[model samples]
Target chain A: MGGPRRLLLISNSTLHGGGYLGHCQQHIQKFLGQNVKRVLFIPYALHDRDAYARTARAKFESLGYGLDSIHEFCDPVEAVRKSEAIFIGGGNTFRLLKALYDNSLIHEIRKRVLEDGIPYMGSSAGTNVATISINTTNDMPIVYPPSLKALGLVPFNINPHYLDPDIKRTHMGETREERIRQYHEEPNTPPVLGLREGTMLLVEGDKATLQGVTGARLFLRGKKPTEHEPGTDFSFLLNDSNASNL
Target chain B: MGGPRRLLLISNSTLHGGGYLGHCQQHIQKFLGQNVKRVLFIPYALHDRDAYARTARAKFESLGYGLDSIHEFCDPVEAVRKSEAIFIGGGNTFRLLKALYDNSLIHEIRKRVLEDGIPYMGSSAGTNVATISINTTNDMPIVYPPSLKALGLVPFNINPHYLDPDIKRTHMGETREERIRQYHEEPNTPPVLGLREGTMLLVEGDKATLQGVTGARLFLRGKKPTEHEPGTDFSFLLNDSNASNL
Candidate 1:
């Protein structure tokens, strides 16, 4: 069995714009567990190479880091090999997933991170890829591709930008909590994560801790909402708290 | 324009069981508001009258109200002419909408409520009738009828059980928000009300007030989520908001 190591995932961070790279930096610093050395950047989120480079550079500088310290790659396999820690930035998650599947990068990311024990990081769509299925993605599923698999870094589904229940008016639909509650009613479903902005899950060597704020809500089937905080053992995901897959 | 008055609309309050006398309740309440009294109950939601009456009686008792206050009639025109507040109760919205159109009760209800300045309230299927279109409804848009037009009490679309966004998780085709968002993006479309449970919209003299703890989430073009609070002068629909005839 492979062992757990440092990792990060993103669903989306640019709420209105400008926070993408800063969010990435914060995640990188958190996941590297030290100064990040030799990181690989994927240019899949941008249409133009120059634009991607510019955006990447701006993000790196804002983080007090340099673009040259990181390797930019178009090919997934090559990028996966040279990286000590992999960081996926947020854009259109469906587009990102499509590119990863099209380039056959899913296997490389999974093998390197899950099998090779390389540190992994993702934001927004990047965070979305850490799950087994991309169904929980909040992005429009308009860009549906044949492959639905992801890096399988996390077992729970992620819902970024989770809004709370607003009680004051009449609507003709089910609430988000109600929807998840309905999901839980279905037999044998995975636990769903309603991660508000700026929350991260940290897993390293049989110990998984929620790094951000406590009071994050977990919606389980047939039960009231449960609260999870930092250092709460997520080993429930991998069986025993001490059982490392690596 | 007719002045506002009290109205009660219901979808379903008895949980899984649909009310049979729901349509009759609409006619009776409408007639009562208009001073038309006494009618008979028809079990559309239930195959048997005894079951429907039993449930209806229980509902009335729970509310400390009595069915003896008004006559229950399944007949449309006979019920419409005598009522002031038209109330439709909880049952299958599709079935209720179908029955309303099948018997041409749509025109009569509109004529009495809109033209005559009568109050109108509905629940479950009754609530479904207030919207101009039921296309956004979470329930299956099953129809034996060729066209789908609700009573059009409200001007916009209704998406009952409006769920909050979670990352892509389930294979429920598309989430409610995605569906409504796509509907709006379809070029010259109506607005949608994503109403959670325990919420209602109160209409008084040229104004619609959102009621209950969970207010409606408005999905508009080029805007973040906006809350529609109770007692705020508003429309339960998009068409009514702009007063644009579609």
Candidate 2:
């Protein structure tokens, strides 16, 4: 848990206003600091990769930084190695993981973020791949990846855009909390962070805080879900102490 | 598509009015016909196997049929082979398939329904396992099975409790339609039947019909989603004529 890892894992890019990356620009800047000049953008999750990159380029340019899509470069590995910061946009988690595997960049990106201390930021399916596995993602299994294993960027898995159990809805499908509960029941599964819309986790050298306007729900295997408000530090999720008990 | 295959695939076990298997019982009875004496129930989908069987027992008893839980039998294969009808209740799809694999019943159950002309009925996760693959299910991947392949009782996949896209909601998650679209993008994927709640499909020999009050959304790869009314015969879905194009 103790490292010089800088990460801004956002739940969603858009809030209720439908602004593109409108709410998390400040947090992104705060995590990246002033040294990172350009950001490497991975838009492999969605089918509309070009449109996604254009939207992200506009937002990053507005924040006084340059952004380049990995697909634009002939040598994708060198492109990632040369970047100061990395940003991954949201779409289908399976596609994103498959693309990452297809490009053979899983280890390269992991080294850049965890070893070199490069700033890392992602939203939705992007945030999903940063965790131990994409088992907790809300997206469909659009494509079958080589494995469900993901880069070990974080100790716990993240359930992005997590909707709490709706008490009033007549839908027979299992709710988000119940789904995460089932996930926890699996052997050796980590705690799941249910990050709601407009919320994110900002990780610095040794600690991380749940930032933004909304609260998140946490699911530990056997215990009732505990709610954490914005600004709550979740550095414990990076440690394996509680996960062993489960 | 022609065979002596009798099946009733339901979207949900309960309806908005909170009736316990109320909406689909008539369809089930008609599919099973008047000669079935005992039915075998699969309760491996969720943790509440006992409670699920108890509820299903009361419902089936009222319809002049005897229901027994397969878990209670000493030999699960013998139970499935001897049963007059088969019912699978809904819960987690991954767990259900995992359980089926763990019990080594996939081939046994497939033989019972596909070759023996047994009456098969399932709801939600139950219906999901009847498709060629469980790739299009809305449930989370809580656990990984040996394979994503399902019972192959049907020619096409089914998405139970399919929710329509809400125009006014501000949620950023992928709508039901978009998820299915992504599924279709994968190679060799079959057409997906988006079965809305309170609706079901009745299969007799080579003919299959969408029955009940609500209609279903049909998604074929690279085409606009088409809606099918109740009583619409879905015989085409049982053949690979359109699947070869995908």
The model with the greatest lDDT is: 2
Fnat, model by model in order, equals 0.07, 0.63
Largest DockQ belongs to which candidate? Answer: 2
The digit string of per-residue lDDT tens for model 2 on B105-216 reads 8998888888888888999889999888888888887777788889988888999999988898777888999899988877778989999998998888788999998899
| Candidate 1 chain A minimal-lDDT segment of 10 residues | A237-246
A33-122, model 2: which lDDT tens digit per residue?
Answer: 788789999999978788889999999999999999998899888988888899999989989998999999999999888988888999
Write the residue-wise lDDT of candidate 1 on B1-246 in tens digits: 455444444333432222433323433343245343322222342224366556665654443334421224555566666664455554444455666676667777777767777766565555666777555555421223334566776667656555666564422224567666655544445666666555566665455666655567877644465777645556434235473433
Taking the tens digit of each residue's C-alpha lDDT, what string does model 1 give over A89-194?
A: 6654556787787877787887888787887767666777787656555553323345555677776666655546767523433456655554454355566677
Model 2: what is its DockQ? 0.66
- lDDT of candidate 1 at residue A147, scale 0 to 100: 55
